[model samples]
Target: MATYAIGDLQGCLSPLVQLLEQIQYHPEHDTLWFAGDLINRGTESLETLRFIKSLGDRVKIVLGNHDLHLLAVSHGFGKLKRGDTLAEILTARDRDELMDWLRKQPLYHYDESLNTVMTHAGIPPCWDLHKTQTLANEVENILQSDRVDDFFATMYGNTPDKWSDELTGLDRLRTITNYLTRMRFCDENSRLDLESKEGVNTAIKGYAPWFNYPTKVPHDCHIVFGHWAALEGKTQQARIHALDTGCVWGGSLTALRLEDKQRFSTPCTLNRKKT
Candidate 1:
């Protein structure tokens, strides 16, 4: 009955398989949590998606920015970038089923007993778990509705720069998605600074790492996330874990055993395709 959290697979199925073998994962008894980017950059997008789909109730995933991009691209709301492995998925025979399943995944997950919370990226510094879950439901409702197309249409943006109860409609959805997927840095006022993607030394002016902000972090609970591979798998906080070890860039695919937080990693064989 172990639960294991894995970092961004990015369509690198070989390393994923190796890591699964290393952990001796049992579908009948174990659960797997994915930090998203389940497909892209690597060569086996179709295979990766199918593997996950076959997992039934044994797996859980939070959507990443790349995952959202794949959904938008599939529906013609966005265009695929060159070097993206998503084409394999878009052309798959079971494309509709795969895409629909992906869209239904929650943006965040929480476990009460373990006090572990998972999202593709870090939660905003200004948001407590209650507010974060509430906002997550707002988008989830749209994603699960007939208006889903309209939701994806308004999905891209960094506007409303900070969270406010006043934010409504598409602006509010965009802000929530950014916090759950693209967020990294924030200013003193807790406004999300979407432009900075560099390491700690090169932070965009006045912005600091979301976890390093002056206020008390969601430190009372264990937080597991990916998407910031440039952290190169480093987080200064014990309760926070950075699992994206840059596997798509020739680093290792990482997995954390939930019961005792034991780690398992396997070297990647990446082709370095940009997405």
Candidate 2:
């Protein structure tokens, strides 16, 4: 049974369907690791969520920034932005069921056998594998607890801009969430550059891609992440896969077969929507 690490779906269900066909995905045997943004910004958020949810144990997904935003909006804690296509999901018959399943997803996933890890964004450079998983669990614990409502209410912010073991309460959880889900650039010190969303070339001075920083993770370990569509599946590192190909912006949907490290892509046909 092979495993395919896929990029963000972003509600582009048609391309995802075609991509699955291209990859010869076998639901009963093979596994799929999705780098989040499973819905929103395209045209079929409801269908995409339902389709992924239907796969049961065959699929795994980490929560992306968009996924958390959807969770917050569903709970009436956040507002929909201009390019959102999540209204259908909000009004769907299975809305409660889907949201329940969604909120239960973790922020990171790892396959010890393959030494392959998956998160919506790359792991923070300062964190070792153990610390990464531990800190991720800190947020996951609160997010899945009775305090979830309060978590969402306080989830939106760029403050405290860095990780500190000394940070307590919601601030720590929020920082962890941002690093795992929203991060793109950061310093060697792990101070996040939350505002720069452009490509590496445009990253403000002294800030480079998070993957550029030295980390405690062994060099051989593979990290599969999405979120930064501008990379177009390029990080120039064989072990690091940046798989968000901007399918919602008329780019292609891409997937990496973990077994052989072969990459497969299907061109997207959706019209770009202004955000």
Candidate 3:
């Protein structure tokens, strides 16, 4: 059996369908690991969510910022932004089932056989693989519980930009969520500079892409992540894989077969639509 990890879908089901065809995906023998952002931005948010949900056990998904945002909006926490296309999902009859299934997804997925870890955003340098899993579990636990509202209430902030064991309650969960979902630029100390979203070149003096710093991640462990589309699927580190090629922004949808590291892609029709 083989496994493939795909980049952010962001509601672009067409490119995803094309990429799956290009990969010659066989659900019976292949497992698909999605890099999250499965909805929002493009025109088919509702359809995309349904399609991915229909995959059932054949796929693994990690929640991204947009995915979390969709949850928050559904819970009446956040408002839809300018380019957001989540209204269809918000009003769909099966939204409850879809959102329930979504919140149950983990924030990070690790496959020991492949020696790979998948997260929507890269792991924080300070947190080793074990600690990353522990923290991610904290958010996942809350996301699937009745306390989920507490998470969304305290979710939208960039303060307390570093990690510490002393952090408690929603702050602790939010810190873990931010690193796993929205992180981009961070320092060696894991101090996140949440404002910067540009490419590595504009990384603001003390900060750099999360992958640039010396991380506690094992030398042999591969990290497959999405969320920073500005990188355009390029990271100098061999073990660090960036799969988000900005398909929702008129770029392309990409998938990496973990067995051979072969990439399959399809051009998106949405040409630079201000994502």
Worst 10 residues of 1 by lDDT: 211-220
Q: Per-residue lDDT of 99-134 in model 2, one digit per residue for the tens?
A: 999988988899988889999998988898888999
Per-model TM against the reference: 0.96, 0.98, 0.97
Query: What is each predicted model's overall lDDT from 0 to 1?
Result: 0.87, 0.90, 0.91
lDDT, candidate 1, 1-275, per-residue tens: 89999999999988999999999999999999999899898888789889998999999899999999999888789787888878878888999999999989999899887889899888777778888788888888888898888878988888888988898888889889998999888887779888888776668778888888643445578889999888977889888888999998889999999889899999997676654
Residue 214 error for model 1, in Å?
4.6
lDDT of 2 at 90: 93
How many Å off is the CA of 206 in candidate 1?
0.9
User: Can you list the residue pairs that collide in candidate 3?
Assistant: none
* TM-score for predicted model 2 compared with the true structure: 0.98
Off by over 4 Å in 1: 214-218
